[model samples]
Target chain A: MQIRDILSFSMHAATANRGRTLLMLLAMAIGVSSVVVLISLGDSARIYVIDQFSSLGTNLLIVLPGRSETTGGPPPLLGETPRDLTLEDAISLTRARTVRRIAPIIAGSAPVSVHNLEREMLVLGSTSEIFDIRHLDLSQGNFLPPGDPTRAEAICVIGLTGKKELFGNQPAIGRWLRIGDRRFRVIGILASPEVSLGEDLGDMVIIPVAAAQSLFNASSLFRILVEATSPEGMEQTRQSILETIRARHEGEDDITVITQDAILATFDRIFKALTLSVAGIAAISLVVAGIMIMNVMLVAISNRKTEIGLLKALGASKGQIMQLFLTESTILSSIGAAIGLVLALLGIRLAAFLFPQFPLYIAPWSPAIALAVALITGIIFGILPARRAASLEPALSLARR
Target chain B: MIHLQHIERIFLVGDEEVHALSDVSMTASDGEYIAIMGPSGSGKSSLLNIIGLLDRPDNGSYELDGIKVSELDEQQQAEIRRHKIGFVFQFFHLVPRLTAFDNIALPLMLSGIKQEERQVRVTAALAAFGLSNRAGHRPDQLSGGQRQRVAIARATIMQPSVILADEPTGNLDRSSGIEVAEILEELNRQGITLIMVTHDPDLGRRARRQILMVDGRIEHDK
Candidate 1:
């Protein structure tokens, strides 16, 4: 048959049962749209996690101590630790040529008061190098300078949250704050850190490392923070640092090193699995759609028995009959796929607008895959009806009416 | 030219054997106008179907244009039907979905004729049958007479050597039936062999040769 004739036949067949055709198209669109929306959401989740992790400083690594495993063999935890890193170790690491900067940190919760305004805040006591390691920016005044390592200087650098709580609508820099019966001068206010994974690092205060050590009764040990010169050299620097630290501690592999890239990879694996699971669920609906297509085609064949016989008697070959039915199925599914893709795009945009934090991004390969799936479904579901129509005997069919 | 010798067609209906055609022998020369008349279940339609290549005789030597068609495969038979034979049914089975023009153009299309030539020939055929004004109308839109004219136009559009019409006017009124018979007779005058099966003796008597069938066998021939 000519291409024009085939198309005309398909259009007539579709219009013959408009309600059924529309319903089938709607079902197919739903299936394809779900796949698009789910995949986009999965992509968005991955991007959100990666963005949150990168905001924490790409060149930094976190070191924790312990090797505890849950009874059910849960994944290993990296940050739960009882032993503290020593100031001597921190100093040695800072002096090393491979290490660009280091900081020994001590953390505690304390009540801070400024002009009758008071609130409990997380306080971090660390050396001046902590600002450089964390890429901290000063918004109001100068950071703590390394001086008088033993005696406590009555100076501190408050974060944006600490400043707001201690002196609301009032100048905080150069003001004095009381912490645990000790008076401290507000030397600087740090800029707000990037909000990541719902955690805000701008809700704390910074003080001198020596003063923190004395106040917390932590004399020799501290939490060591290290930063590499470049992200490219992070893995190599981590290996060397591990080796150095191991050798220095008599071959004790008690410290754990976690790289930013490694954490991102783990997150990628998690979201990839999530995407596949969602796609699999959507595929179930496609199977149902295929069955529906087969049923509709079969009904069409039975309804047009006399028509088929008339064509056959008029010299239509079996192949032509098969092609006609197959074309109908192809047209149905291709249109459904196109509509589904549009619906999916709309769904993504709506979801992003409703929840800005939960980004929904569509991948380029998604539409191509959807079209391929639709065509395959059409062919698979169309075969039975095509064969049935082809097998109909012209003589028997002419006698039908 | 068509010839059938010692043809036998058997049917199995739930363990009972029924002979639709038995020991049937006949010959139709080129340009010959013949009619086979019989009562219902007299094997008139079955014989026409076998001669048209729409059915295979169980045991027979069937020849069309002197080629042994009974020995040919299904594809070969279909090819012969496409190129050498035409069929017109009692119901004027014009496709309900297509216009009268498309119905007449169908045979030329099956033969793979060029589109421009097919349109020219189909237009001429419709005009010759006084269906030019109704060419664009579907079967449901046309009257019974106009529909039969379209069927006749389609049957002769390929200029086939032979036309097998089964009760061509069984569904038409008297004047329309006379018009259809006249059209077939006119085509036969142009040297196309026309074989028709009908129950009306008056229509059967109009043919150059009339054969009477009973119990799957020819009872009389003239």
Candidate 2:
């Protein structure tokens, strides 16, 4: 049969049982759309994470005080007594040839009260170089300048959340807030960083490292932030830094080196597996839809037996009869597939709007796969009915009313 | 021309072999109108089916246009049926879903005739059968005579060499049956062989040659 004839025949068949055909198409659409949305969300999450890490400067490396033996756990408390990375280690790493920038961080939790507003917040103390290494954007005044180290300078930069919590619509740049027992002037306000995959890292405060060290009166250091020249040089730079730190600490394997890309890759694998599992579950509905198509086609053949016999008697060969029925079923599935594709696209768009962090990307391969799946479903389910129609005895069928 | 030499058709029903057609032999020349008349189980329909290539005989040599058809494979037989045979049935089995025009165009389509040629021939056939006004009407929309006319139009659309009508007017009234019979005879007059199966003696006697079948055997030939 010609392509036009097949298409028209299929349309007629599908329209003949509109409700059932529509339900089958909806099932197929849900299957395809869910897969697309899940995979897209996973992809978006990875992209968000990579962008977050990249903005932190390619040269930067974070050194937490004590490494946790297990992966993915909360960091050990500062007062719980782990071997704290100190100013001596930071100074030695800074003086090393491979290290371009080194900043010692002293972090603590403190309640900041400005007028009637009070909220507990994480506070980090670091040198001016920390701003460049962490790629912090200043919304207001300047960072702490290099000056006398002995005198405690009460100057700080507040994050967007910290500023909002303390000032509440009031200007926060040049304001004063109490950190622990000491009062500090906010020299600058950090611009709110964009949330990446729903993770907001801009919820803290920064002050001069020396001033914080004296105010806390606790130690030489808490954590050290180091920045290498290039990511490619990371391995060698890490080796040199580790060797130098170990040599200073009398040969100890106490530090861990982790890259953002490796963590992102692990997340990607997990989400991809999740998406496939969800899609597999949804695929069951497609099989059910296929069975429905088969049942309907069989009924159509039975209803049209005399017509088929008439055609056969009027010179339609067995193959031609078979093609006609097969074409009918294929028409049903092709329309279903087309409808499914449109629904999937709409579903992805709706999901993307509902959850900004959840990206729903529909790859071109998805529609191609849907079409192929529909075609195969049509043929596989269509075979039994087509065969039944072809096997009808022309004489007997003609005898039927 | 058509020839059947010593044709025998047997049916196996639950370990009992019933002869649907015994040693039957007949010849039908081009442009001849013939009818086979018989009661129920008399093998009249079975003989027509064999002649129409709708069934194969258990033992026989059947030839159409001097080509031995009984020995041909299923596909070969189907090819001959497609190109050489047409059938009009007792029920006027037009597809309910198709319009009268499309029903008549079906055979032309199966023969792979181009759409333009099919349209021309189908239009002519529809007009010839006085169905031009009902071309777009489905079988249910047409009367019994009109449906029979559509059936005849479909059967002859391909211009096959032989037209087989098995009780073509069985479901129609007397006047409608006469109209259908005249259409078949006109096609036969145009040099196409026409073989019909009927139990009505009046209809049987209208044929130029008549064969009477009884108990799977030809009782008389005239």
Candidate 3:
């Protein structure tokens, strides 16, 4: 039989009962769209996270006071260590040649009141070099004055949210701000609505590291940010920071030195596994849809036995009979998948519009994958019914038995 | 020419074995119109099915136009059926999903005939069957006679040498039956060998030759 003939006849047969064909298409469409949407959501989350880390620069390394035991995969989610990571230890890391820039951080929460607009919010203490190391953009005014790490300067930088809440529409730069019994002048407003490490930078305030340590009456540091001279030197920089800290702590390794890629890789693995899990759940629907198609096709064969018999009497070969039946299923599945793909892309587009920061996107290959899988499953399930139709006895079928 | 020798066929209905056709031998030459008449379950339909290559005889030697068809493979037999044989069933057996034109053009399409040629031939067949106005009508939309006319058009679309028809007028009224019989007789007059199985004695009497079957055996050929 001609391929076109097989296709046209199958199209007619498949669409003959509009209700049954619609049901098959609806079931397959639901399965396919679910796979595309859910997988895209998972994939988008990974992209969002990795994008965050990359902005921190590939040569960056994070030094925390506590060591998270690395038993191969991701380290256990743990907290502060017994050993203290002091600003002195952070300063000492400059001894290594691989460490090109260091920005020591001391984090704490304090009540900041400006003109009775009192709010308890997070405060980050760091050196002037933090602007370059963390890629913080200054919207107005100048950044912190560079020079001494122990200067206890009272000047600070406020985030967009803090600036909005405290000063309303008024100018925030060069304004005095009160935090934890000490008064400081706002030197700059950090721009670009950034969120890092689960903390909205827009909701936090930053001051000189020494002023923060004195205000909190604490000598231990929160964590240190180190930027290597080049991306390739990050590993060596990690080892140098670890060694420098261990020597300072009586030859004990208590601090965890995590490279930027290490954190990015961890997030990458987590979201990939998440994507796979959701794809698996969605694939169950595809399987159920396939089985439903098989059931419907079996009924169709039973219902059209007379036609099958007639075709055989008209000299249709077994292969032609099989082709007719298979083509019906293939057409249904392909059209269903195409519809699902369009729906998913539109849904992702709408979702991206709804939650612009969610990074809603569908991978180019995901639609193709969904389509290919649907087609394969349709053909696979079609075989049994096609085979049944092909093998039907012409005489018995003609007798309508 | 069509020939059969000592054909035997049996069917197992649960635990009971029924001889559908047994020790039957028959022969008919080109352009010879013959009718097979018998009561229900007397193997008339079985004999026709065997002759049409739809059912295999257990022990028989069959030849069509001098080819040893009974010894041929299923594919070869199907090729012979496609190019040399036509079958018309009692129910008209037209595909309800297809229009008369598509139904008649089915054989042509299966033979991989081009679209333009199929159109021309199907158009000619519709006109020849007095169904030119009904070419676009589906089986359900056509009357009993019209459906049978469409079936005959489809069956002979490939211009096979022999037409095997089982109860061609069984589903029609008297006038429609006469009309259908004339169409088949007209085809036979055009030198196509016509073999028909029928329950209507009147239709049987009109054929040039007749075979009477009883109890899984041919009683006589007159």
Candidate 4:
């Protein structure tokens, strides 16, 4: 038979039973859409995290007390306590020429009250250097005054949400708020939210490191932020900070210092595998859809026995009969794949609308791979039924009603 | 010409071997109108199937138009059937999903005829069969006579040299049955060999010649 003839004939056969054909189409469509949507989900998650990480800062370094996973070997001395990441250690790191600026951090949740309107939120302590190294956006008043790193100032900066809660459109720069047990004047209100690792900048407080240490009643710094003089000096500054810390902490390197790219690479690798796995899981549904097609085809063959036998009696070769059946499934899957692609796009569009900050879009190869898989699956699963139909003896098949 | 020699067909029905045809040999020349008459289980269907090349003879050699078609492979036999033979079954085996026009065009499509030629030929067949008005109706919508007419139209659309009709009028009323019989005779008059299988005495009397089968063997040829 001509190719077009076979295709149209198969299309007619497929549409003969509307309910059955629609069920098979829906099965195939669900399988395809799930694969595309799940893969997009994983990929978008990976991209969002990478975007947030890259937006952190340029030539940035984070130092935490004690050994973190993937950083160094076990502590050199057994049964000996490692020293804390202290303010003095942060001050001493500035002695290196490759170091551009430093922000000593001491973070803890504490309630700050202004005229009895108070709620507990994250309180961050740092210096004026944090304003640039952390890419902080300030909407009002200046950040912390740059002064001696050891001086404890009675001043603080509130985030946008915190500012609203405590001041309510009232002047806040000169108001005094109580943090822990100390009274500190509101120095500035931080800007709207920025990508700051895991914390929401819109709902936190910022203060000087000494004031935070005095409020928390602790000498240990939560972490330290070090900015290199230039991109090329990143490694040099890292080495200098390490050497200086080891010399000060009795020649024992017990701190964890990490770069932005290292964490980003780790996250990228994890999400790539995750995306592939979810897509793999979704492909199983395609296999199931193919099986459903096979079952439906089997039923169709049984119902159309006389029709098949008549074709044989009319001199249709086995190969031609097989072509007709396969053509039907191919058309089915092609339509299903096209429908699924439109659905995935609409789903992604909805996601993009819901979360505008996250870049959610279709990957170029996903639809191509999905479509190829669906077509091949339809054909492969069609083989058994088509072969059965072709192998039927014309005499016996025609005997059926 | 159609020729069969020493044709035998065996069936395993519940592990008891029954010979549907045993050593059946026959021949009919071009444009011959022959009917095989027999009681139930008398092997008329088996003989028709072998003659149509729809079944393989367990032991025999059959020739058509001077070619040993029994020795041909399945594909080669199908090729011969496509261009030289046509079939009209008792049930009118028109595909239920297709309209009468599409059903008539089936054989032409199988032979890969161009669309314009197929359309023209099918249109001519519809008009000749007096079914132009029913061309768009599916088999279910067609009456017994109309369906049989569509089947005959489909069988002849390939313009084959021979027509095999198996109880072609068995499903129609008396008037429609005579109508179908007249149509088959008309095709036979046009020099297409017509071989029919029928047990009805009245229907069998209309044939130019008759063969009687008994117990898987030809009992008489007259």
Candidate 5:
């Protein structure tokens, strides 16, 4: 028979049994929609994390004082403490060719008293280079001046929150605030930006690294942020920082150098695996839908034996008979897949509306994959019933009432 | 032309083998009007089915128009059946969901004929069968004689050389039955070979040649 003729026959047969066809279509649509929606959820989570990390910084390398081996396990938080990273080590890293600038950090909490008002706040100690490296904007006065690394000038920059609490609309610049029994001049007040990565940028105070070391009575630095001039130099700059720190700490590689790209790559791999696993779990429903197609088709074949027998007597070949039934299933799956894609889009929209923070959207290839899988399962499950119908004896089938 | 030699068919009905056709031999030239008549279980319908290529005889050397059809494969037999033979059944066997026009167009459609030509031929066939006004009605809406006319139109749409009918008017009233019998006779008069299986003696006598089957064998041929 011609393809058009077979298609028409198959379509008429499907429409003749509307209830069964609709039931099969519903099963297939639900299966495909689950796959698309679940995969979309996983993809949205990955994009959200990547966006948050991007907001943190670019071409950044973090140097910590302790070393931990990464051997398919979590990094050891309290691993070997070989040697301390001091101001001298951070100073030596600045001499490397790939390094652009460095911010040696010393973090501690102290109470600030301006006359009768006193408030305890976190104090971050770094150099003037930290202003450019961390993309901080100054709302008033100047940042700490460039000077000798050991000079402990009693000057500081307060965040907008600190300025509001201690000074309370009073001029904060050039005001003397007592920190740990030492007086410091507040030279700059920081402008607050939106909260990113859950760290409030407006609640901290900044001072010179040398002054913080004296105030806290500690010679060791907490962490060093190294900024590479360009992304291409990030790996080279990380190696140079590690070597510079290792040479100063008695030939022991006691620091971990992590680039932003390395963290992003790790997160990318983890999210990709998560997406695949959930999509695989959702594919189980598609298999069940295919089985339902088989069951319905088998019943249809039995019910239409007389029609099949009539066709055979009119000189239809066995292959033609099989093709007619297979065409019916292919049509069903195509319609079901289309409906599923629309439903998945609606589902993603509903989720996004409910939780505005979640970045939910369907991926590009998910619809294509869903459609291909639906077609394959429909054809595979349809084979047994089609073959059974084709194998019927024309004489015997016609003999039946 | 048609020829059959020592055709044998057996059925295993629970542990006992019933011989549906045993050592039956027959031949007829082109355009011959032949009737096969017998009581139930005498294998008249079985013989008609075998002649129509609906069933393969266990043992036979059957030839049609000099082709060894009994040894042909399923597909080749189907090809021959499509172009060389047609069938009229007792139930009319019109696909109930299709309109009368589509019922007449089925055989041509099955043979991969184009829709435009199929349309012209179906229109002509409908007018010839006196069913032009009933073209849009389904089989259930048509009268018994009209349904049989639609079946005959479907059977002859391929313009086959032979028509094998099994009690073509078995379900019709007396007048409708007579009308259906007249149509089959008219097709036979047009030089298409006709082989009919019937139990009615009066109907059997209307044929140019009669074969009486008894106990799975040809008891008489006249």
Candidate 6:
């Protein structure tokens, strides 16, 4: 029989039993759309993480004291055989040709009180270049003015949440707040509405490195953020920083230098694996759907024995009978796949709308894969029932015994 | 012309062999109207099935239009069946999901005839069977006589050389059964060989030639 004729005939048979056909379609559709939606969510998470890291700065490298070779978990605290990374160590990195700039960070918690209202918040101290390096935006006044690295300027930038808590909508730009025994003028308020890697950007305070060094009563820098002059300069810049820090520390090579691309690549691998594994789990449902098709087709064969007999009596070959049944299942699955794609798209849209930061995106190959697998599974599962139908003896079937 | 020689068909019932057809040999020329009448278990339907290539005998050589048919493979036999045979059943056996038009178009569709040609043939068949206005009606919506007419139309849709009817009017009322029998007679008069299996003596006598079966053997032939 012609392909079109077979398709139409199968399609007619499928539509004839509306409830059963709808149930099968629904099962297949759920199988496909779950794979799609789950994978899209995982992909969105990957993209979001990569975006957050890229936002930290392009061609970036972070130098932390002590070595950490592990992909995740807290950085292990080793015995103090390694020398600390100081402000001088951060400044010495500027000598490398590939190193465009550096911002040494010292992080600590400090109680800042204004008008007798005190709140303890995270405080990060860095050079003025950190504003440009970390892409910080100012809602009001300028950030810390450029000056000597050791100069103890009593000035700070509070984030939006801090501003609301410390000053309560009163202008915070020029207010003075006490930070652990010293008072500092607010230099700026951080911009509204930004999140990096699930961290709210408007919930912290920034101060000059020297002022924070004295306020926190410690000198070791938390991390040194280095920017390579260009993307190609990242490797050379990492090498230079390691060598410079090693030379200053008597060639111990005690620090860990994590390139931004390496971190992003790790996250990408992790999320890709996550997406693939979840997609695999979702594929089990497709197999279930296939089995359901096989089961339903078996029942259908028995139910349509008279029709099968009629067709056989009309000179339909066993192969033709098999083809007709196979065609029916494939059509059902293909339509189900199509419906699944539409449902997944709708689900993605709803997710994107409900949680704007979730970053749900559909992978291009998902629908193609889902449809191909659905069709293949439909046929594979279709074989047994088709064979049974084809093997039916015309006389026996017509006898209805 | 059709011919059969030394046909043998056996059934296994609880490990006992029951012969359904026993060394029966028969022949009919083109356009012959033959009636096969027998009581239940006498194998009239089995004989009809073998003649229509719907069943294969254990030991037999059958020929249709001078071609060796019993020796042909399943596919080759199917091809011949597709082009050369039609079957009508007691239940009418119309696909309940399809309308009368689609029912009649089935054989043409199976033969891979294009839609336009299939439509033309089906339309003509519908009118020829006086079912033109009932083309869109499903089997359940059709009267028994109408359903039988549609079945006859479907049986002849491929324009086969021979038509086989197994108790074609068994489920119909007397008036509708007579109507159906008359349609079969009209098709036979148009030069297609008709072989019908029935237990109704009155209907059996209407055919030009008749055979009576008992205990898997022909007891009388005329």
lDDT of 4 by residue, A260-354 (tens): 76788899999999999999999999999999999999998988888888888899999999999988888888788888888989999998999
Write one digit per residue (lDDT tens) for candidate 5, span A169-223. Answer: 8898888998879999999988864466765667778999999999999999999
- Model 1 stretches astray by more than 4 angstroms: A67-83, A94-110, A124-162, A178-184, A187-194, A206-232, B107-118
Minimal lDDT window, size 10, model 1 chain A: A67-76
lDDT of 6 by residue, B80-167 (tens): 8889998888999999999999999998888899999998999999999899999999999999999999999999988899999999
| Candidate 6, residue B193: how far the Cα is off, in Å | 1.8
> Comparing candidate 1 with candidate 5, which one achieves the higher DockQ?
5
Docking class for candidate 5: medium
Q: What do the candidate models score in CA lDDT, each in turn?
A: 0.82, 0.78, 0.90, 0.90, 0.89, 0.90
Scored by TM-score, the top model is: 6
Worst 10 residues of 5 chain B by lDDT: B102-111
RMSD of each predicted structure: 4.1, 4.4, 3.3, 3.3, 3.7, 3.1
Clashing pairs in 5: none
Q: Write the per-residue lDDT of candidate 1 for residues A20-59, one digit (tens) a residue.
A: 8897798788888888778777777878888777766657
Q: TM-score for each prediction?
A: 0.88, 0.87, 0.93, 0.89, 0.90, 0.94
B159: Cα error in model 4, Å: 2.0
C-alpha RMSD over true interface residues, each candidate: 2.1, 1.8, 1.3, 0.8, 0.9, 1.4
lDDT of candidate model 5 versus the reference: 0.89
Residue A324 lDDT, candidate 3, scale 0-100? 93
- Candidate 2 lDDT over A250-310, as tens digits, reads 5554666555445556766776676567666666767887888788778778878887877
Supply DockQ values for each candidate. 0.46, 0.55, 0.68, 0.71, 0.71, 0.68
Stretches off by above 4 angstroms in model 6 are A69-80, A198-200
Which ten-residue region of model 6 chain B has the weakest summed lDDT? Answer: B74-83
